[model samples]
Target chain A: MAELVKVVVDAMGGDLAPVEPVKAAVEAVKERKDILVILTGQEEVIHSELKKYQDYPTDRIQVVNATEVIETAEPPVFAIRKKKDSSIVVGLKMVKEQKADAFVSSGSTGAVLVGGQVLVGRSKGVERPPLAPLIPTAKGVSLLIDCGANVDARPSHLVQFAKMGSIYMEHVVGIKNPRVAIVNNGAEEEKGNALVKETFPLLKEAEGINFIGSIEARDIPAGYADVIVCEAFVGNVILKLYEGVSSELIHKIKDGMMSTLKSKIGALLVKPALKQTLKSFDATEYGGAPLLGLKGLVVKTHGSAKAIEIKHAIFQCVQFKQQRINEKIAEKIQPAQFPAPDKE
Target chain B: MAELVKVVVDAMGGDLAPVEPVKAAVEAVKERKDILVILTGQEEVIHSELKKYQDYPTDRIQVVNATEVIETAEPPVFAIRKKKDSSIVVGLKMVKEQKADAFVSSGSTGAVLVGGQVLVGRSKGVERPPLAPLIPTAKGVSLLIDCGANVDARPSHLVQFAKMGSIYMEHVVGIKNPRVAIVNNGAEEEKGNALVKETFPLLKEAEGINFIGSIEARDIPAGYADVIVCEAFVGNVILKLYEGVSSELIHKIKDGMMSTLKSKIGALLVKPALKQTLKSFDATEYGGAPLLGLKGLVVKTHGSAKAIEIKHAIFQCVQFKQQRINEKIAEKIQPAQFPAPDKE
Candidate 1:
């Protein structure tokens, strides 16, 4: 029998709270029999939400009592330090203790980032772990590393991002020797801010990855590279802008379609096809960004994540565990003298 | 009547070169009489293209002979140094020598930035000159400062961008107060990179500008601020990603619309409304980015700028001059001992 991947989820995190997270856990266990979910939150709240689901298996899903909830606005480091029994902290501790294979959260990004590093810990030789998300592109999806963490990254940090992004895309996403490119203002080797200029040559010489040279931001949507490497500031801007532009475009398109009766009828006719096409560009369908280089997997989803997104994030951990991605990452990074986590 | 705004057009710059530049100059003179354009390029080629336009006022337009062209791939500093007879250099020289009120080019961005700082000179007290362009947003347009120039900008540089961008938006775009916001991953004052963290407090205390707090990229398109400030790296990424996402969405929309006869008919019916709505989002309709803080105006249009964009860029100088923007800029900048050019 295949080994069941036990995933710990922060049930009280995100805007939707235990409702979405708890419901998603039930759905996740139902959809995949080879997975077990540990929902961390106030047991009654989680149980109440789970009771709404009639057919989900009760055995595969369990709730761990966590009395505190971390709000989105709270300072991450301080919140994580003070709220020991918070869902986010409890969930991460489970992973740290090797009781859970992966930890998933739609909580405060700052809290998740800080808690993951501080509690769950870093894999050996990893310097400044980054959050890598799959962004939709015309061809398929590309991983944007350091999306919201490590804003002030060095050239060496970006090289690690590139290597980690390549590893994630290859094993989990199934792209072979993924094409890696550093984000810059222009495609030329010498054109970029100091970080990119320093990192470009290093990316070209880095082994085990296909360095495709610099990619202009304008070329990112065309899926020019499988792995897009950048400091967190650039990556965050791109990710947020991508969401903003997509929403604005969609809103504009709908407004245009509803302006007249003729176009309204046209909108009706084109609705299905347009929806299908836009579905391919939806980031939520692809799960959340994994804060790579951590000892145990820590995935951070949107704070507004719903049941489906949370469900997908839970399933993403299964594949991550089955593929033994952390081992691959440990190999990519240079050996450091830090104590390694005990193997299962 | 109104003081004639003497504008220099780089007739041999951009992909369309002498043809589009010459044609736009003719169109500008015909459309507005209070403007004189001095075209710089290989004179014979510009003249040949100019000859194609009939019934244009000949007296207001003049051509200067320049024998060289700066290709897009050439190193900017070297090109500015070696290609003194190039159109970019000649046009900039015209602005520097006070023969022209402004210099407009759809050439190599690097050469224009380098040439603008070296030839046109910076305003007194300006730390670094920034390229500010008005980007189309949901409500209206917002100025994006430091798009490509000053990539590794200091906190003081961003403060200047905010000040200059606010001035441009108020006078040229004609918005009052022109709320300025620094682009960041999060909207909080403390949530930013090292550069933004240092710039945030300075922006809050900056004089002569309306300072808003940090703006996330997602909020930028909603026209949350009239002036969006950031270092060139972040600005360029936002601008390019905006283009890339818009184009991809458009391409996908067209593909969806053409997938079947029903949607195709729908596409035909919705074409007019869609086209008009999309046109509003076009960046070229807003004209080129002005390399602000220069003693004389230096505007760098897209390399792919067409005749209409060129005409618009030339006419933009008219409003800039008529409004006495440079004098306002000079006053805003800290006083220096450099001799001010005599205002005609």
Candidate 2:
């Protein structure tokens, strides 16, 4: 019917590996006729996994032989350089060479980040590609940019993050004129470290985006802003601690519910509604973190991602391609559009 | 009775100023005959609030007049210097003059931090004083040091923090040979930004502490380490985000439990057991954050603290005095005991 969006899936990556990846590719193809998936990994392993699925369009899915796999423990840059035939590297190269419209991986986060940059490369005028993930918040969800990509980012880098994040939230996440805010210890503009202080005024003066002021971490889960901007170090801490605190509390509540016979019966009554509410907050349901500003779309899902998450990540790439997020990012981050802040 | 540990309560501080602080002081003196409290604020306000409570030991609680009040919005350094007659300044000055063994406040965090360092002063060889708060964890509580003070910290400063945090945790929290870990994005030694990278090696080689390498933010809530060390910016994010995520999830759970009639009945049944279980994670139940390395103890309660939390903070000072936490810190952080790392 329409032009197919070709997405390369890393079959040998993540904890579940070929099983989950292959299953997800099949599920994706079954649901959507306007996409094709190229599963990259060891030929035999992928073929055997594919055999378990029947009655799928044989022509839509293809297997590309990749002899090696990049272990999570290996150094990312070295792994990307050495493992040319690995699924992560091969899939990224396919995107680089324009063979695929996008690439999806649940591999070593470090490797995916590096390969996404070194292979697919940054778009012209994009200073650095950032890994922007959609974290669930009380209102809905907000895009947290630069979560693990550039730990030591400069003021200009943060400025670009705000711009790119706004574009992403507006287009893919479909939030209109997404409010962008820089992460700070306090709500005041004068309350951040050197980078945030420098970037605050620039964000206020930046063009073509809805720039809100500084947001404290306490207001983050309340969803005060649609896009949360910070250096990778701060973003990583926020992301991980968000997961850590929520899971711990959930565990404690469950334990409390089962401590007594009355509460145990109560737990059964509230279980379905509670599960439905929490499901809205699940990160995996939102798919992968996209390494934005890349020449081609590249998404990195969790290393522990299951088949459902992989399927969502694949579907996510379709929207990214359809919405032309990269072109919008390129236009917004153009050097001519963003002037450097005056030196103090 | 043992020698009285005189504590100055800032009756002009916090959201519930003279009311809560005065009540807490009266409560503290009634609970412990070995402790005395000095309420510093407007004399009339302090006296009137105290008059509401009859039959409390009159001699144990005294009101010292402070004419000025420091608002939370005022710049910390300027307010501490100009507002000499403010309750915060007067109380800290009393501790400096040895008229009080400890100073407790539910006032502005910034003014308290600045006043603690400037008025109460640092101990010998203490490069910087850090704000260390005990955060609730899955197992129990862990001390998160430098949560708001020393935002732009150096490697040597963090090393001192680790040492100071270890001393406080082992002595005050009663955790013997407490495990100390620096916050990092990853678990590996080579996996941090400039600050964390430089501090990691120094922490490893430092003596008089049990060093447990790098800990990611995800492991923090699981009580992976007894003393969690980080510069203020990262630590602040972790602390605030920990609170943010937990409160939001708890709110969501309550809403979910009341969404339907069946669930509403179930919520009532689970209410008591859940409340008890969640109380263990309430931070105010533990007490205030102590500004370590000071000549006299200074504890900062939350700005929103009620009478109960203020009482707990006062009781916490009694333990600090009894355990000789300052003396232990003075011994542990001596420059001779902590050799500087070799310059790269």
Candidate 3:
């Protein structure tokens, strides 16, 4: 039998706290035979929540006491440094120490990013680790690299993002030779700001990845590219705007449907199909964003993530470890600057 | 009677070209007696299209001969420099020469921006001219400044954008002391890229405009601020993403609503209310982006603009001229630097 993949989850993080994390871990272990979960949080709180899950597999789940919790509002670097025993820090360290195959957190984004870098460390030859998330498009999903990690990114950084994103999409998301395009104002290479304009040619010449030319933001929803490369500022704006617009539109539609009796009947009839279609666009269905290029896997989900999203995020690590993605990433990223000393 | 507010229409621009431009001019002239439109294009083609409109106000609309047309694919600077007799260039020159109060084009955005700066010239003391467009929000419309004009914008340029956006909103849109906010990835002042971080404090301290600190992209549609300021790159992304996401959502909703017989009935029943609600968010209702801080107004509508949009854009010039927005912009922007050389 294959060895079990041990995953460390920050049970104290997120809005729902120990309840959702403990509940999700219980559900995950029951559903999968080759997975184990280590819940890092205050022992008493975790145990109390675990008791709520009856007929659970106690053997697959363990508890590690973390004395502190990192609040969302606190500064990330300082908090990571100061709160060494916090759930986030503890969970990340377990992955680094090889006690866990991966670390998952739905906590303060800054702290997760800081912890992922400082504690988990970067893979060999990784210049700047980027946060790549799968955003739902009309066709399916496209990976948005450097969504909020490297904001003031240079041209070189963007090229690396495209490379890493291509690796993720090809291996993990399972798209072959994914079409990669730089996000720009116009489709032409001459268009875009200094960063995009400079990065366009480098991406065009980069090895391995299928480099499509520039893509306008308006074409993003059409799923024109499998891998969308952009600096964090642009990526963040696109991601946030996508979320904002979808919710506002749904709100407006619901309001419109409820305004009249005839429409109300129509709403009831359409709710199931509309809900199903919207579910396809829901960010949670795709799981969390992996802080790619880390020495150990670190995934960050939304702060308000529920059991389903958390469950998907944890299972995501199983595939990540099975594929040995970090080794592949190190190989793809830097061929000469730094070679993996351990590899033959 | 008051002197006519002469407007220049680029009849050879946009996808519909002379047909839509001629039709729109006829409608504008019929709607408002105080406005006159100078249709600049191949005089024969425009006249032929004009003949389709029976009993049109011949006295209020006139045609001016412009021999060339600027294609959208042409490089903006090269096109502007070479296509001297193009409709865009001819219309802009009319505004510069004071033969027209404002210039309206649905042609290439690049050409319009280039000609607006070179031909119309910048208002004295204005560091850079920004293309400010009114985007539909849930509450109403908010002005997005520097949408595509100044890509690599400096902090000083953003301050001027905020000032100009404030002036346009208050004078034209009639929102007093309109709350102005800089678009950032996060709401925290320290949380943006280098450009936004540098621009924040300056906007906070800048006088005249109501600076409301940083606004996240997600909160934009909530109508949190009347003036949304950013460098052209970020602003353009926000605007395009807004367009992309809205259309995608509408498309998905329609598809979902038609997938089943029950939902189709619901779709038909809810069509009226939904259409009415969505019309409030339609961008064309707000007219074109006015390249703010120009000596004379230059409004750029979408290339796919129809007759109604063109008519609205032309009438928009009337209000801008009536309010003397340019003189006001100069007074507000450069009170300390130039002191308005010819001020009363």
Candidate 4:
């Protein structure tokens, strides 16, 4: 067997907490012999959950005691600093000390982001570590970078996003020469806010990436680009609005189907095919968002994540380790690759 | 009949050009005896299309010749300045001269915005005129202000947006003490970009408006706020992404319904009820985006608008005139209603 990829799972994080994370860790180990999980949380709670599972390799999943929990409402930087034995902080520290290859958490997004940066640290020469999530599009999934990581981002930050996003899509998502585009109000080159207008030309001149021009939000769901780049503010709105509109639309459609007896019968006939079709667009199936450019892989799943998403997030870390995404990011984001820093 | 509300129809605009605009003007005059339309375009083309509709009241619809046309690709400021005899310019001039109560167009968005500001002009103390469109929501429609008008907006500008948006929603849409919220990444007051962070306190303190705190994009489609306020860049993304996702999902559902023979039969049964249910959520049914704070109303319909949308936009002007929305805005946005200007 190949060398095992050690991934630290935050068992006390997210809405489902120890039960779902422990379940997922057990399932992941049973499915893949090339990976092991360090389940971090309260020792007794994790052990109690683990008892429900049987016939798993005893040594593959280990429980690491963590006495503290970082609530989602806590200030991220303060929590990371104060809650030293918290599951999120402990997991990240393990990665920082080189005891684990990756850290996966569905805990407080802010805490995870701070811990990922302050604990695991940024890869050398990487200016900002972005959270890039694979959002489902009509053609396939497209990577939306900087969704909630950095707001008020400058032109230089966006250019780096394009570069890093291209690397992630090409290696992990397996898209060859992924087309990168900046989100703008209009398709025209001159049409954007101040930041987008400044970044458009830089993206066009950037090296080692397939740089497509500006993409309007109307073209996003049509899968017009492989990697969508923007500041965290616009990117967050796009991500959440996509969720809002889809759920609202689905609810409306179901209401329509149930309004009449004829359509009610039709609903039964159409339910299976529609469900299968929509399954391809389910975001959880794609796993967690990776805080790219970190020294060690750090994945942040939804706070409300279930067992399947946690399992997928763990599996995702395995691929990130196997493909050596960090090394590639470090090589691509070297100081020599970028222009001189902008003067304030 | 009541005093006639004269509206200038831009006959030489949009994808459908004189055809749809002329038909809509004739239809408008037929449906409402208290309105007159001044059709501005190349005299021959306007007359030619007008000749096709013989049953309309001749005196209620008059053609005013405009020799030039402004294409959508032209730079807005330059086109508004140089295109002296363009239909957009002539129609806007008519509103400036008080020859019409409103000007409605399916032409270039840029030209309409520039012309609305330069020719029709802003009301006293109105810092920036925002383009406010009523987007369909789960409950009803909500006004999304500054959708494409202002970028890199300041805190003062957003405060004005809140004031103007609240006025428009209350007077036009009939929403009383409408809940106003700034678009933010999170629900917390402290959670926002620089612009939103600065504007949040000002909005809460601003008088003459119901100020709710920050709203995430996820809550927008659920009708969480009656007036959704943001800078143009974020607002544009939300508006366009809403369009993109809904269209794509509708397309996917249709594809799924035809994937199997059983579903094809089921689709036929579900078609009528689904269509009826979806129509309420149709954006075009809500009419055009009004360039608020202008001396005379200017409504911009979609470039690809058909007769129904054109008719709705025209009727929307009637309501604006009847409700005196512009007068109400001027009163609400007086200098006394705002704080002192920020130092540069």
Candidate 5:
């Protein structure tokens, strides 16, 4: 029999957690019998939430018993240190001990980042574990690395991000030879600050990846590049703005359709088709961002996430585990991909 | 006699420059007699482009004769240093010497930031001169500060930004007690990175401005905040993404409308209304991003700008000059606005 892909989840993490998480966990286990979920939270609170799902396999949905929750207000380092029994820390410990294949959290992002580092550990030869987020685009989804991991990063780090992110997209997400581009003020090679200027040539010279010169902010939604690499500061801003504007646009479109009587009538006539088309704009479909380049996987879902978001996050882990994304990165970095220096 | 509001135009700057700049200068002079536009560029090129505008005031549109043009490829610091007679440099000099009230360019943005610093200088007590770009929102417009001025900035700089941007929005854009917020990953003050955490208290303690706490990106288009404060790198990204996604959505909507005969008929029925609404989404209406907190006014228009964009930029300067935004900013920074030691 194939080994079960046990995933540890911080059930007490998010705003609507325990409830949404329990629903998602039950659904995930129902869909995939080969999967097992270890929900970590206050035993009483989690049990009460999980009681709604009577059909969930008791053995498959075991509780690790985390007593405390990390408040979003606490300093990340302080929270990670003090809240040892917090869901995030406990779930990470499960991954650390190989009790689970991955750890999923819809919790305080700061704690997740800290817990991932302290418990799961960074991958071999990895300078930083970037938060590689899969952003939905017109063409498909592009993996945006360093979305909010390391704020102050170097050029060499960005090069590593490009390579590692390319590995994730190519193997796990199933994109081949992911086109990587450095985010810049302009599309021109010399159009950004010192970091972008330095990273440009390095990314251009990188092998086993399709290095596109540069991409301006406007090209992102159109899916101009498959792997958009940038420092955490830039990546964080882009990801947030991307989420903001897309949501705003959808909200406006909906509002516009509902404002007038005639428009409302028109909206009703086109409701089904419009909803289907606009559903493509939903960022939740892409799942949570992965804290990539870690020994054990950690996925950080949105704090305001619902049951659907949790379900998608679980699905993402399955794909991530099946693809052997890390091993692929090691293989890509082999001396074979790099040419011998003329053998003179 | 009223003193002429002299405007300096970098005629050799922008993609459609010479032609667009000359036409915009002519149109502006016609609109306001107290305005004098000094067209700086290669004399021959200026004359050739100027010939297209037959009704342009030949005497008012004086060609300042710049010998060289700063290519976008050149490093900002090096280009500003070496190209003494470049259009960007000449334009800056015109404003610095009080020959013009404002300097407008659709040229290299980095060069503009460099030239504004090297030429126009900074306002007294101003530690940083933030680039405040006016972005169109559903509720009129918003001022996004530090878009590309200082890449790595401090929490104190953001506090200054909130004051300056609020002043501009109130005095120039005619919004009172303009809601100012620090852009962050989450709406809660406790969320976001170190910079955001540091800035949150300062913003709250800041007086003379309506300091709304952290605002997520998705809230921007629905017009959540009047002034959005962030470091240049983050601000630049948000601005660019807003531009990009809006363009993408417009294209997608247009394409979708043309996909079927029924949809095309639907589009035709709503063509006038849709055109009116979409026109408001045009980037040109807001004109250029002003390098605020400078001793003299400096504006950076889009590089790919045309005559209409130039015309709008010139009008934006008119409002900036007339509104006396700097005086308001100085008032906003009074001792009373700073938090008392006890509060800290």
Candidate 6:
């Protein structure tokens, strides 16, 4: 590896914090020699757990002390301010200070959304920053944007969401000229709520992406569209429901397999393939969602996340580095009249 | 089987029409001896297809002639007004005349939503008839209400949606005292758009239902609650995402299995268990959304529905009959001196 890509992780956030995320961070170091992970939490507690993974390169694994932690219930502004040494706080600061190339957190979703905006700031010229998550589609995975990072979203915001989402899916996920769709109640362009109705025209007029007309939610799973776009509120529901339904179905499938002897035999035979398939569908494989439009990359994992999720998150930084997705996003949003970076 | 429940199907509607739906109806008849189907369409088309099913009960299968077919693109109001001999018009009339217990259609969603409201009308004391669909959940399934029938839904409408959705889940789906919740951005009772924030108190204060605060879309499949209530706009997105995610996962699983020899073996063993489990997750098994609050039962099937979907929709009528779901809904909403359905 040319130079180890550094990723700062919020070790205090998430339900299984420090332990699970720390485990993943160690696992990632073992798997990817080029990845240097800095665990940000209360230094004493984090180092105690780090002792379990002695094989991890001492030079590559460092612990940055963060004494405070933002709880799930605390208000974003209050938590980020009061907990100056919080995992999210110190982790975000690492990216802002160029001490880390990326920041990953399985913490307060509200805190992440706020801190990503207030601390890191949006890329120059971007009007609205969107939260984009890779959603499973028939064509593999499509990036769904605005899953509640912004509410009462405007047309321009959606257009920006489509563009930024498109870039991420193309560069990171490896889909070419992804088909972008504005989620709608109907397939017709004239259909959908006020936001979709206005955004339809702008998305059609957008230059950089493959703008597919309105996509109805029912057709969403039939592997219909590539990059599905919507406001944060709508996107949140789509993303959550998608995850919920996937897990529910998987559980039910396991239940059915255990229902009969013949099926049991068949299930045993297909266990490997089924497991592989389920893994691909697992969202954690892609790490956490990237709060796009930030100057530096800030990815948010679920607060209830465990160690494997953290490991995947650190690995994600490798791809983010390979792509320079942050720089591209900055250029696309701001289109520098003068090449500007690291400016206040 | 208690005397076969007869369902009047609007054969003239739907994309594949009398062929696919007829095939499905025939299959349904074979599967259940308690179903007597009345296929309404162009007499010639119905008989020609029926001839293929020699096992079809000659006395049980009745053909009701309706020559005009209403296309989805047509104006819903115009079709309801002008298409007197249209399949939808005839079917609604049959329900109105009590000749059929329920009318099933895979035609235009807009037309169905409108016709169900205008033709069937809302039951006494119902402010507005909402659409409710049973969506699969880990613990079984949850009903999503106002999934497209009311785009501009008010808080009071949603309050009614919660109560009515709870009742349907209890009586029809056989869930006991179903948990009802409004789909919102967060689980907090204070969260969501103006509609949710304002309407939550109403649902909370309302009697005769288990109002379990708010549920986020992601929590839905986790079976966090029994009745997932929201306006048509949000409901539409939830229902579609539910379908899309499942379909995408299934497709990915199928593709993943074919990737390698080892996986293929695993796929074979797990296929039966997967299928049995996957079937329960299929939205098609749940029939269609009922245009609730209507004076009569009007079921809307998937726009691209085939015969099996239609048969399932017809079966919904049987549950409606057995549970007296409507009567219960009416009683719950109109407690003798309840105010009008709208607090808007």
lDDT of 5 at B118: 83
Query: Residue-wise lDDT of candidate 3 within A1-344, one digit each (tens)?
Result: 46898999999989988777887899899988888999999999999989888887899999999999999999999999999999999999999998998998889999999899999998887778899889999999999998865588988778888888888888888899999999988777678898887888888777888998988888888899999999898889889889988888788888888988877887888898898888888999988998888898999989998988899888888878877888888878874465335523
Model 6, A237-304: lDDT tens digits are 88888877787777777787787776677666667766877786777766788888887888888777
Query: Taking the candidates in order, what DockQ does each have?
Result: 0.77, 0.81, 0.74, 0.82, 0.33, 0.52
The TM-score that candidate 3 achieves is 0.96
Those runs of model 1 whose alpha carbons end farther than 4 Å from true positions after fitting are: A336-344, B335-344
Q: Which residue window of length 10 is worst by lDDT in model 5 chain B? A: B334-343
Q: Top model by DockQ, which number? A: 4
How do the residues B193-255 of candidate 6 rate in per-residue lDDT, one tens digit apiece? 777788988888888889888898878988888888887878888877776777777777677
Clashing pairs in 1: none
* Candidate 1 chain B worst ten-residue window by lDDT: B334-343
lDDT of 3 by residue, B206-274 (tens): 778899998888888888999999899888888888899889889988898898888887788888888
Estimate candidate 3's RMSD in Å: 3.1
Q: Rank the candidates by DockQ, best first.
A: 4, 2, 1, 3, 6, 5
Q: On residues A170-288, what C-alpha lDDT tens digit does candidate 1 reach at each position?
A: 99999998999999888777688988888888787777789999888999999999999998988899999999998998888899889888888888888888888888889988889
Clashes of 2: 0
Q: TM-score, chain B only, every model? A: 0.96, 0.96, 0.96, 0.96, 0.93, 0.91
Q: What is the TM-score of chain A alone in each candidate?
A: 0.96, 0.96, 0.96, 0.96, 0.93, 0.91
Model 5: CA > 4 A from native:
A10-19, A40-90, A124-127, A154-159, A188-213, A258-271, A326-344, B1-3, B30-34, B41-90, B119-128, B154-163, B185-218, B259-261, B324-344
Q: Give the poorly placed runs of model 3, Cα more than 4 Å off.
A: A335-344, B335-344
- Model 4: per-residue Cα lDDT at residue B10: 96
What is candidate 3's local distance difference test score? 0.88
